[model samples]
Target: MRILVSNDDGIFAEGILALIRAVADLGEIVVVAPDQQGSASSHGISLHRRLVPKPVDLQIQNVEAWSFSGTPVDCVKFGVTQFGEQHPFDLMLSGINEGRNLATDVLYSGTIAAAGEAALQGIPALAVSLDGPPFPFDEAAQVVRKMVDRLQFKTLDADTFLSVNIPAESVDGPWVVTRIGAEGYRDRFIRHTDDDGQAYYRYVGDVVRNIEDDDSDITVVNKGCISITPLRYRFTNEPAMDTLKTWF
Candidate 1:
């Protein structure tokens, strides 16, 4: 299968490199990723500035790689739009993200955003994330490769994609299909003064899991299981529309 791989962690990140290595045996891989960090950039595309994708040597023989001066979503856009005619892709993979993107994190994760972009464009996609530090990037990637091999991409809809979150440790339980649950962090901003006496603030946050959420991504990962959540592009609340119809 021809695959288009992209990530928010830039081209040289260990996680992306490991992902490339893990999936190399699958098929022809074309990687177009951001030149720098793009973690929580979400689905915002660069509209004003010219997005130029520069060819970069990833040192991985036979695998074409490019570095784009844009967000993760932008990288996917550039790749699929510019190269789709010549090298039509069968699948799109994003992440092996350095950090976990679970629950509400999907709203702000550039990793998921990239995969979501592909899903919107009639392509099957998967976004894999690693939870916490001491991340076994290479190992997590291999798990994704195995999972991908088993998944029937043909069954997936044009507006659907999968959001996968792997535990920092080994998975002892079964990989569970869960819903996006409550995940919130306490935000803190420490004020600092620069040499010019200008006030600056450094942001700090800590993850708080909803232990009560049994059928959720956060709780699933905490229980030593891989969380696989099928995400779709339809945001129009069907139930809410019914309620609105009564009001009108």
Candidate 2:
């Protein structure tokens, strides 16, 4: 299967390189990633400034790659729609992100957004992330390789993909399918002004387990297990539909 690989962490990131190397034998890999760290950029796209993509010779692992001055979603959309038709891809892989994309964090994650965009385009995709900063990517890459080997691509429904999160250690074991948790970040944002009087707001928050009994991505990662959450484009509140209808 031809695979399109992209990331929020840019092409030079060790995590992306590791993922590329691990999945090299699977099929043709085409990488189009952000020119710089897009990190928690979410599904944002560059609208005002012109997106500049330049061919890069990052022969580190000899993966065909390009760098785009855009968001992670832009990378995937541009790569598949603009570049992939010349050499079509059967699937898309985003990240091996530096941090875990759990719970509401996925909403703010450019890594997950890349996969989300691919899914929107009817391509099966996966978003892989590591739990902590300064984590070893080789370990996570190995897990990806193993998962890929054991996976059956046909089992996935149309326009769906998996979100994988690995614990902050070298683990050789089975993965656990889990639900996205309800836990969330605390402390909120910190806004300030710079010396030049430019206003700035930083999202400075820590993960908080507020519920005494809550099943979420936050708790799953805390228990040191690989979390595999099957995700889709649909967002519905079946239980709350009646309540919402009453207001109408």
TM-score of each: 0.94, 0.90
Instruction: Estimate, for each residue in 1-248, the C-alpha lDDT of model 1 and write its tens digit.
Output: 78899999999899899988888877788999999999999998999998878898877755789999999999998889887758788888998899889888999999999999989887789999998687898888888888878874456877999999998876334799999988788899999999999999998878775665788887788888999999987889888999999999
lDDT of 1 at 186: 86
lDDT of 2 by residue, 116-156 (tens): 89988878788999987668898898898787777735657
> Which candidate gets the maximum lDDT versus the true structure?
1
Candidate 1 has its poorest 10 consecutive residues by lDDT at 149-158
Query: Clashing residue pairs in candidate 2, if any?
Result: 181-216, 181-217
- Per-candidate local distance difference test: 0.88, 0.83
Give me the runs in candidate 1 sitting further than 4 Å from their true place: 171-173, 206-211
> Could you tell me how far off, in angstroms, the CA of residue 50 lies in candidate 2 after the best superposition?
0.2
